[model samples]
Target: MIAEPHLPAELATLLPPSLHALCVTRRHDQGDRLFATGARPAHMFFISEGEVVLERASPHGAATVLQRARRGFVGEASLQAARYHCDARVLAASRITRVPVIAMRTALASDAAFAMRWVAMLNAEVRRLRLQCERLTLHRVQDRVLHLLDTEGERGRYPVPAGLKSLAGELGVTHEALYRALAALEKTGRLERQEGALLRVAL
Candidate 1:
């Protein structure tokens, strides 16, 4: 059996001793296998390191990445419903802390702080999804790219971390189309190409 890793001091305090000692494994997954799939309320995860890509599959077997979870982000919906509504896959080598569904519910029922924190986390997820929907519905490709840079860029200067191909995939368009859109943005003063990352709309 694996020894449980230390949780953030704040989080650890909220959990009962029964849960604090629970083991969390580090894993790397390729392609699509169910780490958590559909609305099943059985488990919850706290990502300690690396990234997890959350996506929903279409009826035709197409998967669209909804968001990428970095370190410290918690993936909890899995343990709430009957099944997971989306799929979670490790984008790189990842360290994750797992908590059994029953433990989570018991904590929520007993610890006010834990319940509040969980509710806050859920609210944030909802807001993020709403923003994504707004971007997909109202923003043009150029606007989306600009917005992404504005939101993700560090300081006023940062290289475009993701390539046009990846950007296109996220935006649900062809790479050529994204390139054309980027070109248009480049022609204007909205975007500037640096050595690697493209600087956008100065911080």
Candidate 2:
């Protein structure tokens, strides 16, 4: 028999051990729709590998990516929601662990330490959202790009193992626009595109 995939250590440590036994892990292909807007929340999904995105479409048909989760929970707000407010789709081939909503709720209600850890996790997500909001408010695409590197990237370098185009959706810009901005930055010697990453060049 094949062994079940376990939760990522960062998340596994936060959830109660009892909940770990209830997790169901599976592999998903890119473009798989995990859940749709208006669907009743059945489970909380944790991305163990690859990317999953939460998105919502406007009346004009433009989709806004609310979250691009590579190694963390997706749509965590759905735990208390009656229905999903946005669609959850796999942005890249992924391994995911699903915890039944009811089981998760019960664990939180019964496990104070686990609940506190969960709250702290959510707070960190909130800060990321705030940073994203700030990035979106910047008028220049290059400014947004630099802001992402400065904040989300490690040591001023952002991994682009999937290439920079993969970031267009999260950055709320067309791939063409992002490419142009990156090229302009490269011309000015402010950015360096290396294999699998973009580095900020110090003046």
Candidate 3:
């Protein structure tokens, strides 16, 4: 069932009144498929809780994850598409807001303040995707882990190693591969797993 959305007070205040009025907040369970490839763009979403992965299957039948969005907008780039080009999967129980495409377009065209916010959100998404591309260029699992830590951490470390499998998923690798990499790093005294989703780099 779609429940009322829970957005940060500041974000709630920033949403243009018209767009905000049309937004539908709801709860989506894990494994829900919000949209599929080639579907008409119906709504733009914001994740208030949990995660969603934007993935597309390759010609070879392997899934290539384009984005694993935890917060903010998920399909900002597809709001204008006649049909969605990828699958939107919910990876965990989540709160989300779905703003119909027509409402989004209206706000972007008629509301200057909302237009600026939308542009800024799109720019941020681009920067994140670029970083992911750069991370994907590395051949080694350890390199990928370090790259994620470097880009996503605050001072060279994540506080916990709790989500190793999820980490592997984000890196487009299997759970076993991430486990092996973490084990190897531990053997080399390079990384240590700690409590509370913490993974520390041993210096």
Candidate 4:
């Protein structure tokens, strides 16, 4: 069995006491398989650090990533499903909290306040996924980058949460294409990178 790891204490703030008490932290190396498609959904993983991608097979037999998470709950929808429809793969060395699905359901059933918070979190996750889907549909790399700034940023600026290569992947473009897009944007004064990985966009 893979060994569990210690999670950061700050995560306690996001979860209710009932749910937090039931979470067990675990460590996963890069490329670890956290769960497989059609597996019984016995647990929900909350990512504390690093990254994980949730993917499913497309009709063309290629893997299509449905979600990418660096922090927050990775499988919030698993609570409503008996089995997972997508595979969860760790993209970087990670610390994740595993919460027993049964216990989580019981908490939702027993605690009205916690249930509302859980529903709110799920709604926010859906909003984020919708934005990601829209970003992936744009054909141009610069359009994707600009859309990210508009949707994910404030005041025409967005912080780079991960490496540029990873961001390119999330934007559904090759790293080289994304690099060219960034360069073009910089040259056109449409975007600029500041010292702290902060990207400024001219809307």
Candidate 5:
């Protein structure tokens, strides 16, 4: 048995034993490219620590963050695709486990339990993406910011250890707009920005 400490706790327990030998763990620094758009999918990445974002660039050269993964898998949809649709970039210094895509697909075909868990994980991500879509439709930055705190926070506190710039991308807003919204909210006592988190003030 591979020691639990060797892999992320989530993967150590979730990945089937047959695929264990094929997993490799590595440390990635911020700004490192894990994979690029149009590249063949080679590995499924599990974020053991820190963060990564799936990003795409438009023809005009503007970049958009499609997904931000702090834990669990990034680019789950890549499992079925011939090539990656977006670039996976390390958003922070991170520890990651890479599982060979071929081995993972084989395990899914042969192991019913692991396959079911993978489906459930994808379902949860779908729900988060839905919420993100709804947030993007709101016109006000404060409204979107509040919605994030309401949905994703624990006990009305959302940690921003990665800082507001990262949170801005997640909220689908520019950092300048996010800063303005937060400032207005703080002045109105609508929220409090602590050392590393945002706390929604009780009504």
Candidate 6:
């Protein structure tokens, strides 16, 4: 698993004891439809294990993966304005903590340290999304793929079997096209496909 460097211990501690203590778990495929299109939000989630994919559907019915959340990461967009901006799906069996928005808001108001850490976390997420947008605008698919590997680091290898289609869709490319681009990169020694759908960057 990739280490979450940006999560702050203090922030976790500051969460309401009730929220921090709640236990929620589901099979790998469950919770895939927790959020309906334009669904009103009920609670935010703190993922303790596994990953969740946030996706949005286009008017033409194409689904696009918008983001992925891993352990120690909190999904707070649901707490904002009582409406979810995208659909959330579990990519693997997951343990999550459900935090009521009202409770979270109260805790943040009362805890200065938690508020600061929360702001920092949100800022980091914003920066990451901005970088993704920049990469997606690149003229070449290879460049975009390389940029993703570089940002996610060597351990955050790609071409994951279960998520490849979602990844390609997120990259705005057909799965076949993404595969061809990856093959080209492999031939040039820019990346090596491993046994478990992991792609290691040679650089």
User: Which structure is stronger by TM-score: 1 or 5?
Assistant: 5
Tens digit per residue, CA lDDT, model 5, 1-203: 12233777788788898887788888888898888999999998898677888889989999887788877788676678999999999877778888889888888999999999888888887898899899999999999999989987789998775678999988888999999999999999999999778999977
Candidate 6 residues 117-190, lDDT tens each?
78887888788789888988998888888888777544757534345675676677888988898899898888
Alpha carbon deviation, residue 69, candidate 3 (Å): 1.9
In the order shown, the candidates' Cα RMSDs to the true structure are 4.7, 2.9, 3.4, 3.6, 3.3, 5.0
Among the numbered candidates, top lDDT falls to 5
Lowest-sum lDDT 10-residue window in model 2: 1-10
- Candidate 2 wrong stretches, greater than 4 Å: 1-4, 57-64, 160-163, 194-196, 201-203
Query: Highest TM-score, which number?
Result: 5
lDDT of each: 0.64, 0.84, 0.76, 0.80, 0.85, 0.66
> TM-score of each candidate?
0.65, 0.83, 0.78, 0.77, 0.84, 0.74
- Residues 70-105, candidate 4, lDDT per residue (tens digit)? 768887778889889999998777878888898888
Query: How far off is residue 43 in model 1, in Å?
Result: 2.5
RMSD of 3: 3.4
Model 1, runs deviating above 4 Å: 1-19, 23-41, 55-75, 152-166, 180-203
Off by over 4 Å in 6: 1-19, 23-27, 37-40, 48-51, 55-75, 154-161, 195-197
* Candidate 6 whole-model C-alpha lDDT, 0 to 1: 0.66
- Candidate 4 residue 120 Cα shift, in angstroms, is 1.2
Which tens-of-lDDT digit does each residue in 6-90 have in candidate 2?
6778767888888888887888887889899999999989887668888899899998777788767886778899999999988
